[model samples]
Target: MDFIARATAIVGGTMVLLRRMSAPAAQAVGLTPTIPEAKKQGIMTLKMPTAKGWEPGHKPTAAQGLKVNAFASGLAHPRWIEVLPNGDVLVAEALQTERPPTSLMDRVMQATMKRAKAIGVSANRISLWRDPDGDGVAEVRKVFLEGQNQPFGMALVGDTFYVGNTDGIVAFPYEKGATKLTGPGRKLVDFKPGGHWTRSLIVSPDGTKIYAGVGSLSNIGDSGMEAEEGRAAIWELDLATEKARIFASGLRNAVGTAWEPVTGQLWTVVNERDGLGDETPPDYLTSVQDGGFYGWPYCYWGKTVDDRVEQDAELVARAITPDYALGGHTASLGLCWMPEGTLPGFGDGMVIGQHGSWNRSTLSGYKLIFVPFVDGRPSGAPRDILWGFLSEDEKVSYGRPVGVTIGPDGKSLLMADDVGDVIWRVTGA
Candidate 1:
């Protein structure tokens, strides 16, 4: 509230003063500011905590190292990932797009998180990685798709690898050792296009249905879908028939969604509606149920209202809100849960790629986090899995992490960075 009130006041005051003050009068006011040269701040420097997987969680003083690998390079704004059975990796690359602009959501995120940014992140198409002959590092680079508006999140159901593009879903056949899309790619489904265009994909447990997450192109409820013109919602499609319909709605930006293996619960990571000034509503992780309506463009986290959203008395009762709240504006993305018997120390852990923030005073989220789950349920709060993408000197960072997927090896973790144009592979120490 303090931040919002302050910013709002500044906004109004600035506009009024700009209208009244002439350029000459303002110049005579002695506002001769110029970009200045730098000076070292002495021993005073930003101290970034070491990452969890890259370093120890707790110690007498600081943290310790686990192990890390910058597995491959030469990627161009790589986004989401899908690990092939044979250990190859498919990453989406973002070539020409810039990050999205910060909206009201960034204001709240900046207020809530320690180091939130005031803008949106961007990404692009898929890049392929293969380590044939059992090499530890990736040895192959290939394009899975070209000329995508922007692509992210992908899943493999049997032989087909499905990719989420800005306005549609496409799939190509996969052979264990194949390095490229085997056949001409086929369009699986399409959605109404708007600004929030990074569609994410996942297959149902049975593989008969394809579950796709479509974000609201805009934070408001009025963003009309392109050809399909509609509000925000998750939709399900019959794979064979190419038929689709709404699965859930009122979710502002459900960027990352996954299905829990043990309980068949559908878990989603959300970038909730922003702009109430920091603590009003948080981005969330939840087991989104069918037909559920987590309020968007009006209410958040079960009725904490934002001025941007029109008030409705029944909004709280009608919406199926988030289960657990992450701090506001972390810019949460790419969600995957470790199934039982995989990643031993994790038992069952949820992985989210926090793209980081620029809308706040301080920055937050430049790495991956682990949410512990028990018997198909979240047991406690999120834990940092891998950290330290931003350097200690970076009070603000240029790198933003976008998506994460478990490495196909079953013992490693994979992450995508839109800013860095590379994939980071973390293995247990």
Candidate 2:
């Protein structure tokens, strides 16, 4: 290994030891998770499982009465999924753009991500999949759109397909039965890129507006809050006029978004800030209110002040507490609403794809989970819908789940496994 790689490996090993000696193995999770006192670390926990793609005949473990199969394989870092009106599936393949390490932490993160097989040239395209026979496996695959700027989220509203590129929301004229889009698209809104780069898009239920999740440019606004303007919030774009405004503010890295069917409220999964010990603040699933603030760079988990950042007593007081915690550093990034009986024993709830964590000592959220809901609020504890992403020893990862959506058949679940380069379909066994 090179000097930086060797240094990173040594540092990572030391952090693992320090973590074991300092804190308990259990991490806080669920709606009423125990929030431990923040234990700041000089180097912070940096334990990431080495990426090992699934072997032949290997697959994730599905919940009881359910089975999983590869809906499509041989993808290139597929991170997001969208189902079209014509029963077609669209998968967005992209990865983070490598930036030069500016600090020791940056160098460690870069090296660690490389070790985890996360650093690579983005595929920068969306592929279309078709399962005409309803056999779960997609026999037809085509490049629907190429040369996107690290696209993540996708939506189609009345012939205009919207894609949330890292730097902007782009719109293209999409026909109902067309297999590919060949026209140059127009930019709907520009977003500041880098830092947390995945832009998740969801259209309003009434189809009048589009909401885009824009994450912070830095953790805790370390680069100065001024650099974080127009970020760390969801932006709403009115289709009538080509204008956009911040819908909700202070979400650290609000990613996947979905609308609740019962109450028609917008819900999102947020990845909280790091370096605050194993369980100071938890990543959350919450109903996003318009003009509401949830607190970032000022407070977290409702008015629990994070003293590390510059204090804003007024903003902190107004900070709204998130509804549910998904565990600290779980990296909950994908959200979708599942109606009752979407899966055999699963009731109506939100399905979340936790991309898993690299910041905690013991890993958290390397699987797909379901949070049962009643009326419109989270009612019960989360249950694993699919797991076994990590090896028994937890040092090797076979796959990482990102985006999730109901399958075209409306009876199954489709999830994107980026590291494994496959789309998995889940249904009744």
Candidate 1 residue 6 C-alpha distance from true site, Å? 21
* Ten-residue region with minimum lDDT total, candidate 2: 1-10
Q: How good is model 2 by TM-score?
A: 0.98
* Residue-level lDDT tens digits of model 1 in 338-420: 76455446668678888764333234567677778777877775667666667665443445677777787777777776555
User: Cα deviation of 335 in candidate 1 (Å)?
Assistant: 1.1
Candidate 2, residue 111: lDDT? 77
lDDT of 2: 0.91
Q: Give the Å shift of residue 64 in candidate 1.
A: 5.0
